[model samples]
Target: MSDQLQNLDLPYFAIFLTFFLAVLSSLLVLAPTQRGISATWDYLKQVKFIERNGIVVSTYIVIAVSLWVVVMIVAPQFFMVELSFHDGTVAADVNYDYSQTPYTFNNYSYVIFGSGSDDSYFNVLHLKVFLRTIIASVCITLLAFVLCYPIAYYMAQTAKGGTVRLLLICLVLPFWVNEILRAFAFRILFGSSGVINSVLIGSGIMDEPFDFIKADIAMYAGLSYAYILLMIFPIYNAIESLDHNQIEAARDLGSSWSRIHYRVVMPYAKPGIASGCTMVFMLTAGALAAPQILGGPSSLWFTQIITNWFNLGDWTRGSAYAFLFLLSCIVFVLTVMKYFKVNLGELAK
Candidate 1:
């Protein structure tokens, strides 16, 4: 840890170099050796297809794809996975890069098993938070759907041109402010001496102020509001495409309002419902700002654990936590898709 020590990154550099060389060698072996270089050489000859699009367009596409793959997605995640497998230590604590430390499952084991004993507080607390997050996210999605459906229907179907434009402006106005600022606004509204309390107390509605944040109501409300737009637009787009004549014909057949919506509107909106619910659920589960700003002490989301690990200089544990969270969200998405009987192509629409 002392300044007198030589470069501590040397060991880590050596390990990285080894990994790079191994991958490069494998790629080289996979390249063709026949006709000039081999099948790989023949593959390079396939560049003619790209050239058909014109050199400029081909060059731009290649650069964009390469950047997306290497910089935006693969490289960072690849290193994070590598970090997750290694037991990371502070560089200041040793003479070497600590790269000599054997790779481990300790980070993942800590998460799956617990921070301490099998039934420790951390183990129980984290599990509880994870479950609560999933349940709360689903609840938020349902709430948003219920609240937005009527408004979306009116806007997309019944509203005239001016009314539609006005409603859209209303929706966009609230989001012009920063998301964190909106969260803080919710915090103020729910605080003990804040707007709700002032009105309730003035009206003699209760004997004392209610702690909405402590009760976690603020978190639920904030999350639902935060992702409301995601739910609205998808359903709007789906319903907008439906023929009004079908609804009129159903009404002519003496189908009640409930039956009309149940049999007609909902079937047409299935893809939108699936898409919106999945997006809301994922966003709500991964939410940090709303929970941090508005949730009570009891409302511990999984992202908080990831942040704590990083602040404690434990990148391995943090990466493991992040990866696991991603896997859980992916599973939830697949479940939503299955329940709606919609494939990826349908959902995209």
Candidate 2:
């Protein structure tokens, strides 16, 4: 076997193998691609607006959407996942040859298990940070929901025109400033000698300033506040579409506020609640500015580790971490949908 292998034309064999795989892949994808194209064309032809908008305008719209999906979304992700398979050490080298470099799953392995030098098998430190980030994000999502639901209910069902306008202005006012600036404002307000502490001391309500920043309270508050509008608007939209007569009927039946919301209001607002929760959770998980500015000294967010890897030129590991984070977020969204019994089409609404 060794003698025969040594006698073979290795380069020619490699070329033949590559060509064979390419042909096989193309054959596999060709049928599905053709079917998708045919379906899209049929749908476009049946669309009502095509007659008014004309073929040229419709063609331009399709082109724009395709370009946006391919260029802005798909291409970057494809490159990222491609880069993740390479050895981080080799990928970081300035003079490295891409084709000659070997691929390895060490980046992902390190994410799951400890470095080879470690006595323990699991990557406890990184896993702990990842779990903490997920839990904190969930808490922030729930906090936003709790704070926004009442305001949303009022805006949808009870508030008069002038009152609604006033509430909207108040809600939208703080968001006019940059997010980092808002985080900084929270930092100031929650600082030891900041407004809250000062007021408490001035009124003789407390003896010494509390360390809200060190306790991680500021980070939580900032995260909750940052995405409050996202939580509010969706619930309000869902509740607004709900008929007022149902709430009136519930009240006429002597239903308590809690019972009304639990049985009637909430079931109708499932899609909106699910959408808002998904948005808030994803945003909170990905947030860097608020956590960096307001987080306690001991706090750690998972994105910070990913940023560190990229900043240090370990693109392979960074991409792996990023793809992992993206996958986790996608799983979370799917879980939320399953739990709420809502589908993607309903959530989109």
- On lDDT, the leading prediction is 2
Residue pairs in candidate 1 whose N, alpha carbon or C atoms collide under 3 angstroms: 32-37, 32-38, 32-39, 32-40, 33-37, 33-38, 34-38
Per-residue error for 10 in candidate 2, Å, reads 15
lDDT string for model 1 (1-349, tens) is 3541343455754664565454344323322332334554366458574657887887887689668757866577666656765676534243324344556667777776675755554667767777888888888889999998888888878999899999999998999889999999999998999999999999999889999999999989999999889989999999999999998999999999899989999999888888788788888888999999998987788888888888877777888788677667777777767777886666668
lDDT of 2 by residue, 1-349 (tens): 5754564456644643453344334323323233355776786677764786888997899789778756876667666765665677764447432333455667888898957777778988888999999999999999999999999999999999899899999999999999999999999999998999999999999999999999999999999999999999999999999999999999999999999999999999988888798889999999999999999999989998899888888877888888788777777777767777887667668
- lDDT scores in order: 0.78, 0.82
**Model 2 pairs whose backbones collide:** none
TM-score of each: 0.81, 0.87
Residue 286, model 2: lDDT of: 94
